[model samples]
Target: RKFWALARTGQGTTLRGNDQVNGYLLLATSCDGTLATTATPTTVRVVCNNTLTIALDGTTRAIKVPHNTRFDPQAVKKQLGIAVSQWDTFMHRMRTLSERKVQWHEAMGFFMSVVCDVPPNSKLPEVLPNERALRKVQSLYEGGGRGATLESAQGTAWGLLNAVTEYVDHERRARSTEYRMDSAWFGQGAFIKQRALQAALQLAA
Candidate 1:
């Protein structure tokens, strides 16, 4: 029997396909010692446990990795959370430091430019207190130090906020096309949490 599934629902190993059919195919392939993700009578891509082999017609293509691949949702989520948290902390630090100066708003504008994806014209000229993290924004003309160069503050906040905008755009694109809506939702949920953290940081600043 030729079995191919794109949706492994119950199986926790893969979010791309359902597990029931996968279980049957797995058993059959294991017994036959021939498992394939592609269903081509002339070309079959097979994986036997950790080992992978591709057979084209009667000819063997190559022998590669031999290990069962497993995907853990918990692990993936944890990693994503950690990554976002790091970015959030870095942004918060930059914001906090910028707020200390008399021209804090100007510095904020520069900071936003570095991190955000906002339109050039719409970016803030002043370091508008974001929720409280005073972000130091540097302009293109500004030197390496913590202050904003000659660039105005209006666009700086826009730049910082642009990061959030970029994130939202990425989420929208990812959700628009995949069958993994749950994962998509999870991604957006993380974004929301990160934004909230940034907002909280601003409030505390």
Candidate 2:
């Protein structure tokens, strides 16, 4: 049996996600309303899922492809000629984070602040997961492998940013590989990375 893979690029659509996840950005042209794909690149998760298939080439923007287009295998291979390296992306981001410095206490405090900010009047269901998120961050801070390192650049903004990414990409529990991929790109994990990125960038100022 032979399987065919297709590549499409264009404006992507986003679906709302639960508290644990953020949302899905549908990216494929010929999706059967339930097929999807996601790549674990820095700053974004390329994805396909939940009732649609569309493709987009973007870091922070989605450009949609038409649904009726078709291409042969050679075309697919040529377009996506080589695989993107996650480590390369990480090192690039590390350069930025390394520029910004933070103390160990500040790093821990940052995660502490990431726990959901509850309104004065909140729904019961929302609180637990948010609390769990806080605990998860705390766990990572206390002893999440290299996440606990406090040395040179490792203990500052660079370390904290890595802590969040490592937790999202390697630590956080997921239902399956697909689920983890989706969450890493479109769910809470992505949001956390973005937040950390923003925080890290702020330090550079």
Best by TM-score: 2
Q: Model 1 RMSD to the real structure?
A: 19.8
lDDT of 2 at 7: 38
How good is model 1 by TM-score?
0.20
Error of 2 at 48 (Å): 24
| Residue 24 local lDDT, model 1 | 11
TM-scores, in order shown?
0.20, 0.51
- Ten residues in sequence with the least summed lDDT for candidate 2: 13-22
Instruction: Specify the highest-lDDT model's number.
Output: 2
Lowest summed lDDT window (length 10), candidate 1: 43-52
Candidate 1 structure quality by residue, lDDT tens digits, 68-178: 545455754554344323323343343442233324544343334324423234746454433222222132213322222312212233223322322332332343534
Cα error of candidate 1 at position 83, Å = 1.8
